[model samples]
Target chain A: MSTSQAPLIPAPGDTRRRPLVVMRSVSKMFSSGTLALSDMSLTVEGGEFVSLLGPSGCGKSTALRIIAGLGDVSTGTIDWPSSRINSKGLPEGDISFVFQEPTLMPWQTVFGNVYLPLKLRGVSKSAAREEIMNTLATVGLADFADAYPRELSGGMKMRVSIARALVTKPKLLLMDEPFAALDEITRQKLNDDVLRLWRETGITVIFVTHSVFESAYLSNRIVVMKARPGRVHADFPLKTSMSRDAHYRTSEDYRQACEKVSNMLIDAIGGEEH
Target chain B: MSDHASAFVPPKTGFFARNRDTLLRTLIPICVVIFLVLLWQFIITVNSIPQYILPGPLAVANSLYNDWGTLSPALWVTTQITMQALALALIGGVGIAIFLVQSKWIETAFYPITVILQVTPIVAIAPLILIYAPTTQVALLICAFLVAFFPILSNMVQGLKSVDHNLLNLYDLYGASRWQTLLYLKLPSSLPYFMTGLRIGGGLALIAAVVAEFAAGSAGAGSGLAFRLLESQYRLNIPRLFAALVLLSLLGVVIFAITSFISWFFLHRWHESSLKREN
Candidate 1:
């Protein structure tokens, strides 16, 4: 909002679907005197995969956290315009967050970790058993329900984290560099899984990552952000359709998209350096 | 077997091969203990040490068997005091730890006093406690409790504070209430640290119980092994003294073993400290 940078790809405007949540001129200054974000405005529409791409120290994560209601904005407001708002006034179960780390409770089994969101809402284990199993199945971890977090591989643990996030069938999913710790092969597989899940569930995803290729591969819209009091520098949609598959990953169009996004990311960081 | 030969099936090993580690772990300690006892006996015999000064292992064992009726009651008394102090320490320590961890201000306000209580010698406090307490037993219990409480409180406070920041954020994102967060996340995550405290506190409780009784100098039929130890020394019954000392040592070991078992039972499933390594 501060920069007023127009979307490089023309905004679809009134023809676009309803915006699920809109952040208007939001700024966050932590008590530690770190200006994590300044005038970061974003509008995530229903059923769109939006990736917030940036360099290190960028406040993409801070912005995501604030939107998820895990952190309070020092200034401005986030409005859930059309999604169902809970009594807490914070969309409650309608939104789920996947952290950078798997963040599973080592003491809990995969099923228990996945059951946490419902459990917090007072749902009994027996009542939520089938739903928990189904979410685990969706993440390809149906047989690992009774396995503890310590027993899982990095990829598997991240799958459990995804299962936990999706267990509630949330309308909005916020992920903060969810696969940055993973190997390249695993990250690619998970990227495919996440795209498939988003396609299937029609959940609005705001994915945060520094990886240009990943953002290009997964997002319908990419918002390249600049660091040092982070704010949006460029917002654009892919010129191609959303039906991405393994073949599409190696396609000429996808390669061009990745190149464009990569150059934009470089410019975003380079501009800040000057 | 023939059909799967090309598939690289593992060879079946003998029982000893399978259990070499277990055998070594148990047997080495037993062998060392036996060797030490024999050396102690040999030293006493060679020196022709008087029973009043340094009783032989056999003499001490004889006294242990002969004075079982008297020694057993004293052992029971000491055991009861140690256990009661440990149990009370656990409850009070955990309760206060939870309350203190609620805020940084609360922890800063109260944690130093617990450290002070811990550092102040229980032996020095026992005399003052004995004069004011309702009975010698109560004074001993207080001293033991004071000694045992700090390790648990400090460890539990640390454990509660050390919860993964991301996990806490996840809990907040889920809108988990304070109680739900504490019960489901904080408590389970703190358990390994709590177990560490329990093991340390268990041994300290026994030491404090004995030291407090010694400092209080309470003597009677109801007195603990500490009193029996003092009485035996005063009467020049060195064998009985050695026997009582042995029982105390055994009690300490038993407390350690029980605490370790409890720690293992809870943590072996997931905690890194307790997990079995492949090697």
Candidate 2:
């Protein structure tokens, strides 16, 4: 944690890549009179793994929902400048969302659950079989294609969920605290799986999490958020060139990054009291 | 994922141990029925009751064998009415439920009418239908259909409305059309509830068919078992009356069994209500 051993990473002012999504002064107010977000602005590049790190009441989830077109922005515009818009005026198959829960249909088999997004778009089962199997294999669930959601463990169900999300090969993947319910071991394992998937597929990811260690480990960039009319408190890039595996987990750079992000998170929460 | 499946594999067991619950379920019911029949016969013999006042089980069995030629046609009539009513109820109830769930305005306007029909007893309305219908058969069919329709409609409506909110959002995110959502999501989610409705409606349909025939009391070669019961009472043929009563009870049991099998068939794979316990 000493200054002499601090990792030589890029500072927060870097913005050289083309933005895939741009949100300008976005504010969301719920019908229950809760201002979940206020004047939030963010720009995500095409292949960056960005984490929205915040506490429970922060509007990180609200921001993700707006980006996924699941919720309406009360007072701003979200522009997908680099993606194609479907007839519904949203990025149709260009974006995929993973909720906090598995949110799978309990009656469906793993194959069927992973095939849902494609099936909804009028793709036949036989036509999508290969891509579905390949995605399942990527998540290490190729052997569980016939198992029902009720038969699988919690982590396996989440793997099916991730498979469903990645089946479409979307440009932007939005994960809303998808690993929060998992135990420590399963969560760490999924964290590694998601990082590998992100790197291999080159999909821009906006992962929402409250865990500083998680944000520090998986993200190329981290957006720290504050609660009570949630807005961005800090936007910084974590430019570690080390491969994120067990070795990096025990390295001094990873420790220094987590310590830095946790202090910023504490400062963000501490500022809300005044 | 690799080690998780090992714990869930059920341990091997002998055939008897595996089927012990089912064997007990079937065996206990048969024993209780035999005991009740023997008890009934013993009471009759011990009291020296006349056959005219109380026929013994053997006398009733004899009547069943002797009167099969007469009772068979009536049984066919009752069976046809019950089945036709059930099939019609299944179609109409599910159709109306779909129509009502399409919009809040339609549901508000039409759901109350279904409720009213359900609350009015079929017996109270049978005479009115019998007078208005083209024939007595039509009247009986209408009675049974009315009795069976409500449960299916109510349960189907609830099932359709109970779709998970998260699943609905996922459907929307995928740009699924209205029909696609209903076909792929809502209908499948409603299967367990629909099976429950079918089981309840099956029994009610049989009861309504018999009770409606009793209200009609129209006698002829085509009359159901209910009419035979009344005729035997009038003619003082107690053994024949007991035979018809036994056949009616057996018909109820058969209907129950068939409906239960159907419920189990559709839901056994995934539904909690039908899955086997670990023990």
Error of 2 at B261 (Å): 1.4
Interface RMSD of each: 0.7, 0.9
Give the top-scoring candidate (DockQ). 1
* DockQ-based CAPRI category assigned to the predicted complex of candidate 2: medium
- Tell me the whole-model lDDT of each prediction, alpha carbons only: 0.91, 0.90
Q: Write the per-residue lDDT of candidate 2 for residues B166-198, one digit (tens) a residue.
A: 889889999999999999899889988888888
Residue A269 of candidate 2: its Cα lDDT? 96
For model 1, residues B56-80, the per-residue Cα lDDT tens digits are 9999999999999999999999999
TM-score of each prediction: 0.94, 0.92
In model 2, how large is the Cα lDDT of residue A247? 86
lDDT of 2 at B214: 84
Best by lDDT: 1
